[model samples]
Target: MRIRPVGRHALLLDCDNPGQVEAWRAELWRRRDDGELTAAEIVPAAATVLLDGVPDPATTAARIAGWTPGPTATTAAVRHVEVPVAYDGEDLPAVARHWGVDVPEVVRRLADTTFRVAFCGFAPGFAYLTGLPERWAVPRLPSPRPRVPAGSVALAGPYAGIYPTASPGGWLLVGRTGLTLFDVHADPPATLTPGTRVRLATA
Candidate 1:
């Protein structure tokens, strides 16, 4: 683990392990509940973590690395949500073709693995999931779709994600869902918070 100071008030933690990222994410939730690390926010990315407190990034990084894993990591609060989606995307057939597999096989492989949220990006409540099956992984379209409807489940490279809102996108859409991933009125607006374990339910 390496820590670098972004400025005077934040630290960038680089830990390549997804497991390590998860550990810290869960740990932060614990500290937030128990009052250990006092920060405005803990933003966990695919390969990095950001702490919105403290000035000296080097010192703080050392402390966090030596810190022990907390209890919240083991708690049942971490949720694995099953999101049901329609398997009728325009790109579905293309995905099957790209992977050299049938559409049914594509769905089977996608549902086989439990994905972890690598980062929240592109839009509100959108989570970039890591570790999609290699066979089904493909690149984005040559041209970005003018408006990818919300809840569109897609795969590109080794990642899969759901569109949080209607917007332009290039990720190969495999399906769409009616479930709301974000709601401004709610306390935690994003449905798939970082560290959330997710699985897809085909409609």
Candidate 2:
């Protein structure tokens, strides 16, 4: 891991992969909760975690440099959310073809996987979920849609995602849900924060 100053009060930890990033983020949060660290935000991305609004960047950097990440937190320690989906997307057949399986098998496999929120990006409340095995990875569309409706469950590369709002997107759409992923009026606007476990259930 490489730690770099992100300004006067933030440090960006560059991890080797998303798994390491998740592990580090979980450990840092545990430390903060146990009164070992102070930070305003612990934001995670694809393979990095940013410690923002830190009181002492130099000292904190030194402190974390020696720390080694432990195993990922158990499921009981994280939030679990179920999103009911209508598996009737335009790309469902294509995805089935890619996996050399029928559409029903595609749905069954997806529903059986327990996905975790690896990170959130591209748009508000849009979570990049990871859990699908490498063999199930799918490619992005050749061209992006002008507007993929909100709650569209999609896939690209090795990650699955849900569109929080109508926007142009290139991921393969497999289904959609009615869950309100983002709501400005809500206290915690996003439903699927990083580290939250997610399951896509058949609607």
Top of the candidates by lDDT = 2
Cα lDDT tens digits for candidate 2, 105-172: 99999999999998888999999999998998999999999999999999999999999999999999
Clashing pairs in 1: none
State TM-scores per candidate.
Answer: 0.88, 0.97
lDDT of 1 by residue, 1-203 (tens): 67777878888778878667767777766776687676777888877778887655566677777887654443276678888878888888999999888998888877776887767877889998876755556988998989998888988877999998899998998888898999998878998888778888776
Error of 1 at 174 (Å): 0.4
Q: Alpha-carbon error at 114 in model 2, in Å?
A: 0.2
Per-prediction tally of clashes:
0, 0
Global lDDT for candidate 2? 0.94
